[model samples]
Target: MSGTVGPSAAQKRNYYLIVLSMISMFVTTSTIYMVFPLFFEEYGMSGTSIGFLISVGTFAGIVSSIIAGKYSDSHGRKPILFAGVAIYAVVFFLFAFMEKSFTMFAILRFIEGFAFYMTPVAITTMVADIFPPKQRGKAMSLYTMS
Candidate 1:
């Protein structure tokens, strides 16, 4: 038998899927960053309030990334990744119809941030799972560049 060993075909497929999902996630995230302030302004939210909303989401992201990374190690990556995408889709849809309640928006922002960070943390862990140790650096480099 040949001596070289690498990721199996299924692993390679999963790696590609993770890359594509991350690309889509990044696109959706950037779109939200661009559009959210304008959307909030159209509803008459003050600049400070808008900034606070963003800050709340960012803080949630920070907290959730830590929790989700550890959780993924024990619970598995795909479930958390899929849950994150689902939560993002639901929260994004909710944003369209949100009224002027700071509490409601804050809750959504926190959840959105939690959902957003879940994707990358799980995806990163998955990339680590897919490639062998010697190949991981290159795999992660390509994954990040994608």
Candidate 2:
């Protein structure tokens, strides 16, 4: 056996739970990335328009990630994580059924970015909380692998 002790079972469980959430986040994001370009083009958005829309979403994510990190620090990470996931789910569902328009899509994409980003902020916090500093790097590596 190795000299170094490993994480306790509960620690392992929590770590996996966090990883699972990250995986869910990745899945939703990947699905959007795969589908949205085609959908936008089919909806008659020009190449520039599609690029602009994606940029708006990215900007929203950047802004929201900053806000969310502070909010989660004060209010706690779990609520932010759950709200982000919930909002993302709702937005993704709406995308499937909603009618198309540039304005509407832009608004949804903004919300989607805001929601999509909240998870990583809160999740990284949660991982920090669950794992001791010694294991944190490994935990994050596994988290990102999702």
Candidate 3:
């Protein structure tokens, strides 16, 4: 029971997973939104359409977050998280190859909103699960920075 001198391998793994989750969250979210305006503008989308597109994602995110957050508590965080991330990637890959179809983009964005919001709740909870209560705040802060 006295082999290691510093943090255990498990702790290192947990930290690594937490960091990965945070990065995935930021990367997926930022990539979609950061290019939204330029992408839409190229097609001459009106202001109202742009507004509606943004709202569609936001509203879907809210609903997805609520549903996933509640389920994660009873079922467990990791499964939901993995499913969300996997589905999110598939959605993005599909989006990348999609033609200039606004309707398809809108649907994908709705699914994206659902998949994206599901992760933060799970990853945050996993961080809390991995760290002590006193350390959770700092862990969460590190996660949020991503």
Candidate maximizing TM-score: 2
**Candidate no. 1 TM-score:** 0.88
lDDT (tens digit, per residue) of candidate 1 on 1-146: 12336789988998888888788878987887898777787768888888898899899999999999889989999988999999999998997788767798899999999999888899888877777777889989988986
Candidate 2 residues 64-134, lDDT tens each? 89999999999999899889899999988888887878888889999999998888898888777767777
Candidate 3 — number of clashing residue pairs? 0
Better of 2 and 3 by lDDT: 2
Candidate 3, residue 97: the lDDT equals 88
List the candidates' TM-scores in order: 0.88, 0.89, 0.85
Worst 10 residues of 2 by lDDT: 1-10
Which regions of candidate 1 are displaced past 4 Å?
Answer: 1-4
Whole-model Cα lDDT per candidate?
0.85, 0.85, 0.80
Ordered by lDDT, highest first, the candidates read 1, 2, 3
Ten-residue region with minimum lDDT total, candidate 1: 1-10
User: What is the Å distance of residue 146 in model 1 from its true position?
Assistant: 3.5
Clashes of 1: 0
